[model samples]
Each structure stands twice: as structure tokens, then as C-alpha cells.
Target: MSAPIQLRPDETFLLNVGPQHPATHGVLRVKMQMDGEYIVKAETVLGYVHRMHEKMGENRTYAQYLPNLSRLDYLGALGYTHGHVLAIERAAGIEVPERAEYIRAITVELNRVASHLFWFGAFVMDLGGFSPLMYAIQDREHILDMLEAVTGARLTYCYYRFGGLYNDVDDDFIEAAKRFIPRMRKSLKKYDALVSGNIIFQKRLEGIAPVSAEMCRKYGATGPVARGSGINFDVRKNEPYSVYPEFDFDVPVYHECDSLARYKVRMDEMEQSLRIIEQGLEKLPDGPIMVEKKPKTIKLPVGDYYQAVETARGSFGIRIVSDGDKNAYRLKLRSPTYSNMHLFDEACEGMLIMDALAFMGSLDLVIPEIDR
Candidate 1:
């Protein structure tokens, strides 16, 4: 996904695009060698947050390490936590009740929508459009209010347990969630009308940064970054984890392969998430959320266990190696932003600095996960 950087030693000078730049969304610094206004080469500098989540996973017991997963990509915390819990559940041979899996799907999809909503505002703001932030945050508060009522925490929710949820949702939560579907649908229409067709917005994004399917595959990109380039892959559909198989929804793909395509993919994904939540509500079974015969302690059989789940940014994977002990021998995380950020060097070459920032926005990066 990269090319040989043809540096113009005499004409070019270095410029830092981050560390404090609003466009980065975090403390990610991009070192760029610029030839006048065009970038000659770019290098992404990470390690701002020294959060050693992997090492922490090895130090803590399987059950005790739950909270750490929620911090990696705080915006899509549930999906990352979902992968960790799913891996542990698989390793321990625990069976989650049918109702719990449905709840997981519903709550994670709500998290996904919230993630996209924030990204919508922030991404637009990154490109110098300010009003969208107000509107997007306004709509996102409704989702946050609902999530807080059930999960008891909003942003980095550690709600999913090894084989079930922290607790069963109340009737009030269910009714509020049901009402949210239509309200969110109306909100989405308002967003489209307000932002999608705006000439300035379209001009700023469409055809700005084009990614090819070959390039995405080369860099191992997933989620909207790959789907924007027409790669038909989604962990919920392709891998079929948890209750995702029971639900019906389409993986939104756009062949345009530009910034606009990535934007459309996330926007459409919110609606699809709504569809999933609606289906989950309708088919929500009556049963205990946790297994009846639950063990007091969890010990993974000596082996390697892994699980992958689709998050807002992309697929977040967790791998645990255990030696028949309480603590994991080793833990590894496969984060999508790392791979997605890999495309920046090649994607930004020869483009104007502002356009390069626009391209980076399209990637929907969550940098803390990259640091992990």
C-alpha cells in the first residue's frame, strides 16, 4: 500500500500534522516531508498513550482483565469487549443464554451507531464544517441516554460478562429502545438533508482521496475503509458471530472508493444498525440472561483462543494464550486502525496537505487502539 518516497531533498521541508492537530482526533503525529505545499513523504508517529493493554491482560486473571478491553477503542468499546468475552467464553466452554446474545447484539449495535454519530460530527468538523457537530451530538445524546439507563455507563461500557451481560435490561429500557428506532430514523433523514447533499461538503470529500480494493487488501484494511473500495466483508455477516447470524441486514458497500464513499458507508451503517436493533427487539426471547449452571471460577484449558467482532472503526480481535491458570500467558490484540493508518503514507503522497487530512478523516481512526 506504499510506494518509494521520491524525496526532493533541496525543495522539500518537514512538517508535523498532528500531536495537537484537531484533524487527528487524538495525539497522533504525522511527519510529512513537504515539497512546497504537496507532500513528498509521510510517516505516522504513534505511542502517545502508553496504555499496555496486552501486558495488562497477561497480568490479570481472565475475568479481572475485562475492564481494560473497554478502553482500547473507547468509541467502539462494547465490540472490543465483546471479542474479549467471547474468546473467554469459548475457551471456558461456557454457554450464554439466547436472550443474552440478542442483548449483546442490540447493545453493541447501539454502540456502533453512537460511534458513527460522533465520527460524523468530528469528521465534518475536521474538514472545517462546525454545525454538524452540534446536530450530531444532539442526536447522539438520545442513544447515550438509553445506553446509560441499561449499561449504567456510557462511553467505555464494561457491560458484557464472560457468558452474558452485566444485568438484564428493564422494561423501561426496552420501550425507550423501541421508541429510539423511529426517532433515530427521523434524525438520520435530517442529517442527510442537512449535510449529505451540501455542495461544500460533497466538494470537500468526493473524489478527494481514492482507495483501491487492491490497496486495502494489501494493507489488510477492513470495515468502511475496505468496503468503500468494494470489498464485500463484514465480521457480523462474513464471520457470523454471536446472534448476528439470526439478524438480517446488508453490509453497506460503495464502489466509489473515495472519502465520500467511506462517509456514506458509515451513515448507511447507522440505519442498518437500527434495523438490527428493531429485529433484536422483536425476536428478543424470554429467558435468564446468564447461564443457570454458572461456575464460580473461570479457568481456560491450556491452549490458544481467539475471537473477532466488528466495531465501529473496524474488526477488533482478541487472542489469549492460557496455561490452565487464572492469568493468561499471553494476550494479543488485532486492531483495525493500525492497518488502516498504514494506508496514510501511500494515500497522502503527492496530495495537498488539506486533502491528505480529509483522507485521514475518511479512515475513521481511533488512535488509542493503535497505541495498544
Candidate 2:
């Protein structure tokens, strides 16, 4: 009889990728099960920086809670502020002024562009590119300048009031945006040439982390993540609110369901956003920036209401349960990143650690947004 064939035992190792790792973008700990460099399993352990913003909001009055919105997604403060104010206005049955709505829309779209620009730079940087970050920042600075002129703050602007905006966009702000839009479009072409066609970037991202449309819906993915998987479910399109119904723009979708698909979706979204901004500028009407009947204190009708807005990362929903009081009985925030991150557990299985970082970066997570 031949000697028994020697068998090699399967080996497994454990690795902790972050809490401080550069790839995480924020404080996130990913427990990884690895067979060599390939990750067989990955479990993201959050709550590292959780602030419980919802609880804080519930305890504060509507006017007092306005600042908390900026804390949720500091990177996209305007979008967060807009979501909260819009929800409160809807719940209280308040009528926001027409000019105020236009200003809110413009600021939110500009913030969306800034958020996407940062994501574009960071995503490429995670994949081993650097120059795009600098180029993207150059455009983002123009947005910052415009926001600062009206909001008086750069990163965390608390400019959205319950029934309208805190201030108006002056002629200078409009002119700056008009000048910046053409420059941004030109810069986008440069970005397309820089990383979109680079052989190295394509090799790393083209077919990696493919998530099907069914999986995306099941996992509650939104924004570019869902759009990347051929799911056309944008809040702006599906449930139009504010002045989005007046804007002419396409919801960019990709059937590829891979990293490249996500990249393309964001690129296309930037262009669509620019179109929205241009339309908003042209049709912008002149009126009072604040409601004529501004309330001294906000008190909503006793009921529950939800308002959702399309942020740069995904769709953000603010649910307010009012008890006919100045303070909300319950304030629940359904953050897009919270649901989007759920896909990571399934998507990261069997992918290399490096690829996993690329995949996570593609999701464009904001830790506070998830934790809140």
C-alpha cells in the first residue's frame, strides 16, 4: 500500500485593521479573518466615536437643536442642517418663503458638490493616488469661500432656519458660483483623464466589490452605492421636496456593480448637480429670505413626520415625533451611511485586505453619520 498522502492543515490568522488606520478615514475598527493577505471575513466594530446626536436633539428645543445637525455630518454640514430644518418645517406645517427655498437648495447642492469632491480625492488616495485630492480641494475652496460669505463659518455652517434660511445669497455669492461652475466642469475633465483611464486604477477597481441591485436594496444602500448597482431610487427623484421638481437633471446609474461603477456614478452626479445649480440660478426669484410670519418659538403639532434629503453620501431622513411641545418627544435620524455600511460585512468576504479598504472607501462613510 502507498504511504498515506501527507495533508497540510489549513491556517487562519486574525488582524485588526483600524481605529487609527489611514484607510478608515475616521475612527473605525475592522476585525479581519485572513488567510495570508486575503480577508476571509470582516466585521466592522463601530461606536468608537458615537455622540448620540439623536438623544441630544430630543432634549433640546427646535431652535436649540439647530446646531446639532452640523455635528452629525461635519463634512457635509449644510446637508445635515437642511435635512433637520426641512423635517421640522414639514412637521410644524410652516411655510418657508420661496426665496429661502431657493437659497437652501443652492447651498445644499454646493455642499453636496464639496462632499463629493472630497470623496473623489479620498477614494483615489486610498487606491494609491495623490494629485486628485489637491485638484479637488482647489475647487472645493471656492465653495467654502461662497458659504463663508453668507454663513460666517467654513466647515460647520448652521444657516438653515425652520421656516426659511438664516440669510440670503447676495449678488457676490451668485457671481462666485457662476464663475466656479465653468471652472469645476473643466477640472472634472482633468479628473476623468487623470484616474478614470489610468491602467493601475482600473486594474485595482474595475471588477472589485461587485454588489448586485437586489443586494443593494436588501441592504438598504442609497446614493451612489445603490445607483452604482443599477438601482434608481434617489429621494430627489422618487419623492421630490423643496425645489428639486423644478430642476432638470438625470439620476446617473450603472449596472456594473463594482468600484468603477461607483466612481462613475459620483462623477456623473457632479455633472448633474452642476446642471441643477445652473437652473436654480436662472430661475431664482427675488423675495424675502425669511418667512413673514416667523414664530418666536417653534411648536409642532402632536404627530410624527419624516423628511428625507439626498446628501452627498446618500439619503438622510429626519424623523421627529412631536407631542405639541417645543421639544421633540423623539428625534430619530435614519442615516444613509448606517445602512450603507451594512453591505460591508457581505461585500468584504473573500476580498483582499487592500481591496477591502478600496471597497470601504468607495462607500464614502462618515463615522458620526453612521454612529448618530
Candidate 3:
């Protein structure tokens, strides 16, 4: 009798990436299915740093909850705080004073610039470049200094009030932002040379993680991710809340739809934010920084309101359901990164492990934002 033919079964491997890995940029664990070095499937396991922020928000009063927003995206604390305060004001129909709106606009733009700068640095570092991170952080420190003088804190700034800001911007803060603008413009040129034009960066990201416009819409991606895919849907442009209508700036878009395209979009956004800051400084009007008629306590009518603001990461939505009480009955935060990370499942398939990390980094997942 002829011997039976033997065949080898295909091998599947399990890979655990993170909770301590640098590519994660935060505490994220990705369990990947691999056929050799290429990933066949990827699953992201979050909640390593869950703080139960939404549940906590329901228990705290509107003013008391402002401090918690910053903890979501600590790198862009002002943006989170701005969105939360705007939500409360919108829910209660509070009229923020003109000077207060301008100040909020200026400071939020500055915070956006700072946030993008950090992303620029970290994105490059993820691709095996390190020097840009240091340079970017050095420039970002200037914005931090200006923010600290006004907000009294560096990272988690609880500066926004219900009807206005906690305080008005002093001349010193305005002068510092003005001085920082031109210097920042010049520094962009240096960053362009340092990372943007580098052949290595281009090769690593050129065609990796391509997401079509249709896919972005299906998944509700925002900020640079949607823009990179040629979806011109920035909340700042579409919704135009909080003095954004008064400013003239373009929402940067890229048709490339790859990691490289996402990188360029964010780099361009920093320049556009700088322009907004400059215009805000010139057009800022003098008026009361806070509404004189604001009640000592806040009680919204019994209804639900959804407020969305363009954060450095993407669109941050705050939904509050009030039972005519000082504290919200229910509060929900729709974090951008949580939705954006959903794309990683599709984007990382069939890519190498390193390429998957690059794709993940490009998504800019702030673990806290997702877990919040």
C-alpha cells in the first residue's frame, strides 16, 4: 500500500502589544492575530486607565464638573474644558460676554497649536525619529507658560466659566501670544525641514493605512483623520461656534488618505491655528469678561442638549440630560479617539506589526479619551 501523504497545518500566532509599549503612547493593549509578521486581525482592549468620568459628571454640578473634562485629554486640557463649559452654557441659555468669547477663542486656539505640536513630535518618534519630539516640546513650553499665567495651572486647566472665563486675559498674556506667533511661524519652517521632507518618514507612511472618504463617514472619524481622507467636516467650519465665525482661516484637507496625509494635515492645522490666534488678537473687543447677571447656581430646564466642539484630537460631544436640578441627571461624553480607534481594526489588517503601530500612532489615540 502507498504511504498516506502528510500535510502541515497553517500556524496562527497571538501577539500582545502593549500596556507598556512605547508605540502605544498610552496604556493600550492590542491583541493581534498574525500569519507570520503580517496581521490578519487586530483587537484593541482598552479600559486600562478608566476613570468613570461620565458617571462622575452626573454627580457633580455643572461648575464642579469643569475640572474633570481636562483629565480626558490632558495634553489638550483647554479644548476639553472649553467643550464642557460650552455645553453647560448652551443647555442653560447663558449669554457669554463678548470679551470672554474672544479670550476663550484665543486660548483654545493656542491650546490646539500646543496639542498639534506634541502630536507632530510623537508621531515622528513613533517612526523611529526622536529629536523632533524635543524640539516640538520646547516650542510647546512657550504656550504652556502663557497658559499658566492666566489659568494658574499647566496641564489640567479649569479656566472656562459658565457665562465666560474664570478671568480675563491681561495685556501681558496678549503680548506674549503676539510675540510667540511670529516665532512659531518661523519654527514651522524648521519642522518642515526636520521631519516633513525627510525621505525616511515619507517611505514609512506614504501608502500605509489608507482610509477612503466613504469609510470615514461610516465610522464617524473627525479632526485630521477625516480631513486627511478628504472629508471637509471640521466642527469649527461646519458648526462655527464660539467666535470661529469671526475668524478667517481654511480647514486644511488632504486627498492622500494615508499616514503621511494625516501627518501633513496636522502640520498645516498648526499654522492655521496660529493665524486664528493672530486675527483674534487684532479683533478682540473690550467688554465685560463675565455676565453680571449670572446666578450663583445653575439649574437647566428639564431637557437634553448635545454640544460638540472641535478638540485637538477631533469632535468632542457632551450630552447632558437635566431634571431641572443643579446636578445633571445624566451626562455622556462622546470622545473622538474612541470612534477614530474603530478604524484601526480595518486599517491595520494585512500590514506588518511595525506598520500597524504606525497606523495606530497616526490615529492619535489618547487612552484616557477612549476610556472616559
At residue 288, what lDDT does model 1 achieve?
A: 95
In candidate 1, which residue pairs get closer than 3 Å at backbone N, Cα or C atoms, i.e. clash? none
Lowest lDDT block of 10, candidate 3: 1-10
Prediction 1 global C-alpha lDDT = 0.90
Local accuracy of candidate 2 as per-residue lDDT tens digits, 118-194: 99999999999999999999899999999999899999888988888877888999999899899999999999999
Tell me the spans in candidate 2 whose CA falls farther than 4 Å from its real position. Answer: 1-10
Clashing pairs in 3: none
The clash tally of candidate 1 reads 0
Per-candidate clashes come to: 0, 0, 0
**Could you tell me the TM-score of candidate 2?**
0.97
Q: Model 3: per-residue lDDT, tens digit, 1-372?
A: 022323222676889998888889889899998877778788989999999999998898887898899999988888888888888888788999988999999999999999998988888899999999999999999999999999999999999988988878899999999999999999999999988889999889998888898888888999999999998989998998999999999999999999999999999999999999999999999999988997699999999988899999899999999999989999999999998998988878777888888888898888988998
Would you list the clashing residue pairs of candidate 2?
none
What's model 2's overall lDDT?
0.89
User: lDDT of model 1 at residue 9?
Assistant: 86
Name the 10 consecutive residues with the lowest summed lDDT in model 1: 1-10
